[model samples]
Target: MEITAEEMKKSIEKIYERLDEVSPVDFDCGKLCGEVCCKDLEGEGELALYLLPGEELMYEESDEFELYYIDSSEIKYPHSWKGQIYLVKCVNPPRCDRSIRPIQCRTFPLIPHITKNGEFHLIFDETEFPYECPIVRDHIKLNHDFLKVTYEIWMKLITNPLVYDLIDMDSRMRDNRKTNYEIVV
Candidate 1:
């Protein structure tokens, strides 16, 4: 079932509602690593974040993000994906509205996976990142509530086929890379 733009707006908002109050730790995790993850956006045309399919409904040209669209043919995308994918570069980082942070920003240092058998798992993000996230690098202990909410959000998000395919593709890539990261939950 393809999610409509209105439905996607509601779903993304629901995710925001659950994650708005939590952080990986009680304090600013960025300070521990000098905000490396957020600071990476400072470079000229160097950093952009990909929004999941249908997530573009949540933003507009006047928002804090400068949006760009790339043809799927020009980048590596899931076999199931077609046309262009929207990428957003944050105009302000490490200081945006915490409640409306993109899903990628909200779920940092953790990645979601659904096994072939349909079981869900949360793992320390195995994707290659441009900057070192201390939380993942040092195996930081995340707040239990943060972990729970993030896991729950991803589980819900994957019900959309496009999201599921995207996660599955990344999960397969991670498997091919043979990362030995431990599952968070």
Candidate 2:
């Protein structure tokens, strides 16, 4: 069954609260990478992040972010995903309200992975970006608490079938390609 908007909102809020103080490093890692992850690539390309199913409930039309929707058929989303997919871009990069950052931002660097054998693991996100993230490129050790809480949050998230399908689809693609990744947990 699809998760109701109310359920999704509560889950997202709890996730935000849990991740409020946890970060990949003790200090702001953004300083090291010049906040490349948050840069507003105005003319380069659309610098946007995809919102998880029902995550749009947490956002509204605002000056802080430009929100747009794409039909799932137009993207590489899992077949189970239908309807519109929400994408958001910050108007002012690296300066938006950190507390309300999307789950993609909150879980950056480490992506949740489910193995062919059904093993859940956390690995450095290997998605190519226009700029390099120092933390991922340098193999910097993430804070223990950050990893732990992120893992916990993902575990809870995947309980929703839609989230599970998305993660599993990505995992299967990685397996099919024999992609090598460093497992953090």
Candidate 3:
């Protein structure tokens, strides 16, 4: 089944509306120390890149960028899928799917998400993650401004039914639960 661009647009709108239902929460971290954490998800499936809704500027509007590829040679980390171990790889860094990207990467350290009821919530990025993402530390507060941007992307996907299916989640995010401070619930 092919999803039309029109359908995608409407789905996106519905997701955005849900954002308003989230309830905001308050918390603080003393200066997060790191550069940028893109892909340290040991079990979060293949490291994919997802494009935020309307944030087309991420790729289309950009003039400078390089694609990264998955190295098949790299042994799969000791992890299991269904009941077997598999080391997922990104073979095409040149063309990372904007949709298949890991949720962590899309949300960065912000990790904002909406529930089935259109409630917005904030999550904590894995402290154990070893990536040095600058964007992560650039803004850290209970008022997750950065998270909004990322959640907006997810909102578009869910509202638009971007995947049209749940897709493969190898327990996808096991302990990856956020504190779930409602923003608009």
Best by TM-score: 2
**Per-residue alpha-carbon lDDT of model 3 for 9-106, expressed as tens digits?**
55544544444333222422212432123333456554434333332222332233332333323533222212222222234442444343333343
| lDDT (Cα atoms) of all candidates against the true structure | 0.78, 0.87, 0.38
Which clashing pairs does model 1 show? Answer: none
Q: Between candidates 1 and 2, which one is better according to lDDT?
A: 2
Per-residue lDDT value at 58 in model 3: 27
What TM-score quantifies how close candidate 2 is to the native fold?
0.93
Candidate 2: deviation at residue 99, Å?
1.6
Better of 1 and 3 by lDDT: 1
Model 2 regions lying over 4 Å from their true place: 1-4
Give Cα distance to truth, residue 159, candidate 1, Å: 0.5
Q: On residues 71-175, what C-alpha lDDT tens digit does candidate 1 reach at each position?
A: 988988887789989887666765555555679889887888766676779988756766778888888899998998898888888877888988888787777
Best by lDDT: 2
